[model samples]
Target: MGIKIIKRQGQTFKDKLFIPAIMGGMKTTLGHFTKNLKDVSNLTTIQYPEEQPTDVATNPRYRGVHRLTKWEDESEKCVACYMCATACPAECIFIDAEERFDGKAEKRPKEFKIDLLECVYCGYCVEACPCDAIRMDTGILSFTGSSREEFVVDKKYLMNNERAKDLSND
Candidate 1:
């Protein structure tokens, strides 16, 4: 039975001083600064509030904001199964189920609320929906509100993709 104790190399004065590391970082910063100075017009910076991107919604990979989709008959596509809420990692989604008053025995969410501040935008809610009811394709990013209460969106807001007036760019 033997215990192996690995010998470690002690830091020299130069290594402890960290001059090389600092110089490397400064070199990178100065390199970028000189490059920008040479051709400032070629910068790809977007003037966000004034110049909004045109392809946020059209881009397949862009997941902006949540929206509740609808069936062909203009009815909500949700079946009130609670699968989305169950799958949500953030636990931001809340659903209150209510039986349909119509002859059909279908159920619907009386209160479907998603706290935008709490949501991680992981797209798990959309994938977990069996009825294809929810999606994050509105391209309606940059929302603003006076308080946190205004951030918790309801079913009606999600369905119509509303809250445009709350947009920060507005």
Candidate 2:
């Protein structure tokens, strides 16, 4: 005649309400389907080739292309400084220094090349340049080539033509 307090274990609240939950999910799914079908023209995806989305580089500080600057005299402002080469993590930059005809032996890179295929574009070279002769601000986004050799950019190609004027101005 004593009431036994047995713990209720079988068929919890979730199991008891399964039918209602399933009906609710089905209703929401059907609602979404009807809404999508009603306004198919309102879809946000753009047709890539026909309508290219403008590349919006939101960050001004983003590192993209590398530019070699010169002093106002238009001479190579590089002074053959090896800081960039030493700082490069990938060891992509190679520089060959030479003594100028002038009695003062200013370091001048006879051959400077950067293997774009190996470069990480980390802007480490730009930061390491003591003369402010290098910068990653060319605004050039992409470089394309069929082979590895084509991707290797030489100093003549990377050096800014206007850099000499900039050097002279300095």
Candidate 3:
């Protein structure tokens, strides 16, 4: 599709007054203020590290850590297409491919690594996989690492990122 430019209109008397805008902003703010005033549970912050996360994300659509899914026979689902690396805006995924000995046309990833430091957690990589190999529904919200090296996780680690059992139930 070609770019279309719309004509701009100059500010009118109502726009210049700012009272209506201010009132509208206040209405939105007061709505949230009253909502939070009724519900105090949302304001409680869990002290992380010292206090382990009691509740992980409950949303099924929640995207947290990445996981490399497997086939019915426990074979890797990734075909080493590199679409994930190509789709990644942050360029955090690195994969090395080798021909599969099982007489498959698609090659397997000899080595796969993802740098959490560079990852934006946008989930584009999961979307780019044609085999439905990668997913971000692990429910492991809080990932930690003391060093940059620890943040750069490999295929083995990604393969182990199973969804929490409690989260898997619902």
Q: 2 or 3, which is superior by TM-score?
A: 3
Deviation from native of the Cα of residue 48 in model 2, angstroms: 6.9
Candidate 3 structure quality by residue, lDDT tens digits, 1-170: 89999876547888788878899999999999999999988897767767756455666667788889877777788899999999999999999999887654469998999998899999999888988888888877778988899999899999988965666653
Clashes of each: 0, 10, 0
* lDDT ranking from best candidate downward: 3, 1, 2
**Who is ahead in lDDT, 1 or 2?**
1
| CA lDDT, every model vs. true structure | 0.83, 0.73, 0.85
- Which ranges of candidate 2 are over 4 A from the true structure? 1-58, 101-105, 161-170
Q: Between the candidate structures 2 and 3, which one is better when assessed by lDDT?
A: 3
| Alpha-carbon lDDT of model 3 | 0.85
RMSD (CA, Å), each prediction:
5.4, 9.2, 6.5
Question: What's model 2's lDDT at 155?
Answer: 75
Off by over 4 Å in 1: 1-10, 55-58, 101-105, 162-170
| Candidate 1 lDDT over residue span 1-170, tens digit each | 69999876547888788888899999999999999999989887779877876656556766778988766666677879999999999999999988876533389888999999999999999899987789877778577899999999999889898423423331
Query: Candidate 1, TM-score vs. the true structure?
Result: 0.83
